[model samples]
Target: MIQNGFMTLWKSSIAFFSLLLLGNLTGFAQQSIDVDSLEQVYLQGNFAPADSLELLDLLSVTFQDPQKVIYYSETLIQVAQRQDSTQRLFQGYLQKGNGYARLGNQVDALNNYFEAANYSDESGSDSALGSVYVTIADTYSMNKNNDNARDYYHQGIALLRETDDSLSLSTGLSNAGDFYYGLGQLDSALIYFEEAGPIFEALEFRIGIGYYLGSLGMVYGAQDKPEQALEKLNECLEILEAEGDYYGVAAFLPFISDIYEKQGKYRLAVQYSERSLDIATTYGLKEQIRDANLQLSELYEQLGDPGKSLKYFRQYATYKDSLSNIGLVQQMARLRTNFEVNQKQSEVNLLEKEAEISELRQKRQDAALYVALGIVILAFMLAYGLFRRYKYIQRTRDVIEKEKARSDDLLKNILPEETADELKEYGRVQAKKFESVSVMFADFVGFTHYSEKMSPEDLVKTVDYYFSCFDQAAENHGVEKIKTMGDCYMCAAGLPFPEKDHAIQMVRLACDIIDIVSGDGYSEVTGFEIRIGIHSGPVVAGVVGTKKFAYDIWGDTVNIASRMESGSQAGRINISESTYLLIKDHFECEFRGMVQVKNKGMMKMYFVKRTLQGAEEVLLNKTTETGE
Candidate 1:
């Protein structure tokens, strides 16, 4: 079982890498052109420079055929050299680099990228140069050359910062975050993710937001914060669902399933894993398919379903062998070797270029070299300015963190912890039904007359004082304080997670609220008494309203609980018959017979006097005896 669990986690992480890399590549290829249309245009005689550039652009973004990409890029270079167009020449070399990189020819890819870089530099196109630098950085990162990768990443980021290109900047930040995350530097990873999140949100880029949230979820999962992981992942799932991004949805589902499995929710785990497998199969996401099979296999093993587990394990083995046959390992080894070779060749090329520049300098004695040197110095100064700007942004992030915490605190006060997290993540919450829940309501008796006698501030303060106490009491008993309306306070137990002793817990909380409102200090100061009620049944809870969010419950159970409070007298706790049965053994109660409830008709009621003399000790002893 432990081996199966480890395999599940390993496969899921592989799926995450595949999804993240695919997302980055898609972002890099922002604009796609129709290959067929471009091919038709290229076939016509007397093609213009724009036509050749368009064909190269189309081929660069096309990954289905690397050979076709190489062919078209080579053709574009010939045309560009004939026209003597530096811009088109840069495009040709860049497309060739992309093509070779796709074919696992890193040596050729790096050479083409460097050639493109020179042309871009000659043309003074910072945008083109920044792009080339990013590609080179990506290649170095792929080859595990961390130092070279970091240097190129810094250079690329500095160049793009000057252009004010938010798209490239966010992508760069996300890539850097991935780098840190791979190294288990979670703090650095979070900083980059936080910086990129706002940019994606501002742009309303759903795919980018999905990727960011997914990455954040994985980091949280690695840190063993399952609740936080679920929150972020569920939000990512919602976005992908809305955008009809089946591949993204498939990638995230297995992680969520693993979280549920860790939480001991086997039913939910199986549900999510099956969903992931279904979507992955439909979309032909091979990595996700393998991950889902492995996850489901482990989940079923945990659930004691050996037959299903064996079936999925067989499927997992089949796909594992097929993927191995695809030579992913060999390709990686070759890429690293090619990168080393290319690095040496690049140094030799740079020396030859310097020798040519020296000969030209001796022949002409022009100021061009001096101007070039000055530009290099200016670029360094600009890079430094950007670095300082980044530092300022980091400082600004610290302030934002404080504000975000404040807002989160305020939100938690208004909603349950789990519900608040869901709202913050998805911007909405769906109503969910709890099978068995205990609902409680407390209302101040005769508050209308007291309010008329006192000033508005005094009445407000009085209510706040009592409700604050009620809040603490509810929290102490492990209950959800749903909301307070007017003179009434509402709370519940046994959801978002169900509890077997929900009724007992709610009764305890109800007693605590009654004590607070009826105590001598409160009665003398505010001249206020409160009636409390408790009922146990089912209820549906969710957040309502877009502008002013409120976590509330609706159902017959809630209505009955409310009716119990309104029908009871001051300074007493009333409960319905259903709740009475659950707590009768733990508390002393008096039968009130049938009471006339508004919409509930005749319902049996009981007055909970107090805990039986030995009941508290019995409860504590039972808990201790059970090792609960």
Candidate 2:
């Protein structure tokens, strides 16, 4: 897979080489020419030098034939030389360079670009000079001389800043982005591409958007973000397809295919690769054809179709050989050797100029150096102070975060998790009514009497020990422990977060609490018993209070549950009629005759002994197990 991915990248790079030249043809649609009329005027030998120059520029770009471009450019150069028109000469040389570059003749292309630079320098046309510098940088980039490429790119941008040429500036930024992208400097590439995106959009340049977004998509894909890549690439593909730019569409298809393949969408990968192949074949795009074949070959292999994989691999090999015969590597090598030679000569010239300046400024150099040293020392002191301040602030932030976490944990301990979250987010919580919930109340049988006999600390510790045990039991059975009164414990099931098995869970929790208090060790240590009552009905639960927040429930259900607990005897579990209906099939119960309550009228109650074995055995064993 790694080898296949590298091959795909190489093919994409080759395909994009042609696109690099098309930047200059942005307004070609507006430059349409009547070839026959232009040729007739050129043959008549009566046109002005400016008219001749315009004709040649249009012919060079519009023909789509490299030999014709070369012919028109050479003829234009001859006419400009005869007429001593430096601007026309610069244009002719630049156009010739473009033609040679398109034909994969980088040696001649660089020579013509340098010739154009000489004429542009002599004429002092900053715009023309910037354009020549951009072409030279692109050629160096193609040759992989990154240092030279970057140097010339900066020089071109510096010159372009003095001219009002937004289109050229946009193209230069995009080209610089592509150079960095090819070198795998994705962050730097993204900076340039994003800078160009707004310029292209303002100009309503669809072609520029297509290329800019495509570069962004490829960069995102290299970063292993397939979704973002698809978003950019799909937008680019839509624009290219609408404009009937089939070659541009073909160039982007392989990138989409690679993203889909990485996402494990094999069918979409194959579909895109095949579409790329069809478009490339129709348009005779050799680089795209080779890329599509390679992608399809690997995709088929992943899909476990060896026969189709082999077929596409064979086609890929044939096109790969054809691409090699185009002499791209040889051209790049020659271009690199020439660039190195020119760069060394230019460095020598710069050193000579620097020596002359050094001799002229020797007297002032010492005073300037002393002033620079003092400023540097002062700046360093300020920077050090800022750095220390930053460290102190970071430490303070860390301490604040730690304390915040501790407080949040404390708050969660006092309230239910969901209620605590809501209170923190909204500053208050609205009460919500639950149609049905299980409310359980547990009270120590002789808590008040035992407290009066023992020391205050001893009494508080003993109560804490038993309530802690109850807390654990409630948590284990998924019951919410609401709050505890002085001698009574209060809790419920199914508020804050709803649970369908609230009644069942509450029953289990009550049983666990009974077992904990009646244990041999527990009874001997504290000499206390617990009474638990559970009743199921509608209740409204919420956090109440602006300062000291408390989560509590209210309704007739709470009243009945309290009555059930108060009416119960020692060491036994009592439940109201509402809760017994919910868990009748699960536990054995004894129906206590109707009991009168203060607020609530007569209510049916039951004493829960132990869980039943089965529903049929409820009738067979009507006996209730008495507490120890």
Q: Find the candidate with the highest TM-score and give its number.
A: 2
What ranges in model 1 sit over 4 Å off? 1-50, 62-123, 139-145, 241-247, 274-284, 290-628
Tens digits of lDDT, candidate 2, 1-628? 4255645355435324433443345324543466657667777866885687677666655554556777888988997888888987887887788777656677898899899999999998887788678778888887778899899888987798789976677777787888887778999989988998888789888777887888789899889998899999999899878766676788777788888787788899899889989998987767677778878888899999987986787677677667676364444444444445798875666677679879868857987899899999999999999999999999999999999999899988888888889888999888999999999888988777887788887777777888899899888877888899997999999877888768877887887787778776343255688887888999999888888888899998898888888988887889988899988876878999899877777888899877434423542432332121
Question: In order, what lDDT does every prediction score?
Answer: 0.76, 0.78
For every model shown, the clashing-pair count is 0, 0
Worst ten in a row by lDDT for model 1: 14-23
Alpha-carbon deviation at 335 in model 2, angstroms: 31
Positional deviation of 403 in candidate 2, in angstroms? 97
How does residue 292 of candidate 1 score in lDDT?
A: 79
**lDDT top scorer:** 2
